[model samples]
Target: MKNLNEPTQENVEFMIEEIKVKLRMATAAAMQASSFTVERYEDIKDLYEVVASKEKFSISEVEALVSELGQLRK
Candidate 1:
């Protein structure tokens, strides 16, 4: 999310789109679910919670999450 910082209408939309993409990819997989899938699911769940919660994300927290996402690709 370039801007899923709080609950701004735009940011919520962005977060929803991001989650949808993840969900679609997961569902589209022909292979059986594995630990990797589980991990990604958990990550999505955590992201949903963060975006859904009323609390605003701190700069450091967002940075950490961004870093985590980058690491996930590797």
Candidate 2:
């Protein structure tokens, strides 16, 4: 197995692009679902309000949701 911590330039670039693709897909899926669907709209709306409100967004929570959002895209 390769050393996970010691990533090469190519590996880093691939990871970055992969994360970008996932983020974009996650964002699109979220927007579509939130706007058109009603399954989890209330929950998502609450979360969005918390994140987009006058207060600052929670970094850890958003990062955690990024993974959850990526899963939701699938």
TM-score of each: 0.37, 0.34
Best by TM-score: 1
Clashing pairs in 1: none
Question: Local distance difference test, per candidate?
Answer: 0.44, 0.40
Worst 10 residues of 2 by lDDT: 29-38
Model 1, 43-67: lDDT tens per residue? 5446656645634556666555555
**By lDDT, who's the top model here?**
1
How far residue 54's Cα lies from its native spot in candidate 2, in Å, is 5.0
- Residue pair clashes in candidate 2: none
Q: How large is the C-alpha RMSD of every model relative to the true structure?
A: 11.8, 15.0
Lowest lDDT sum, 10 consecutive residues, model 1, at 28-37
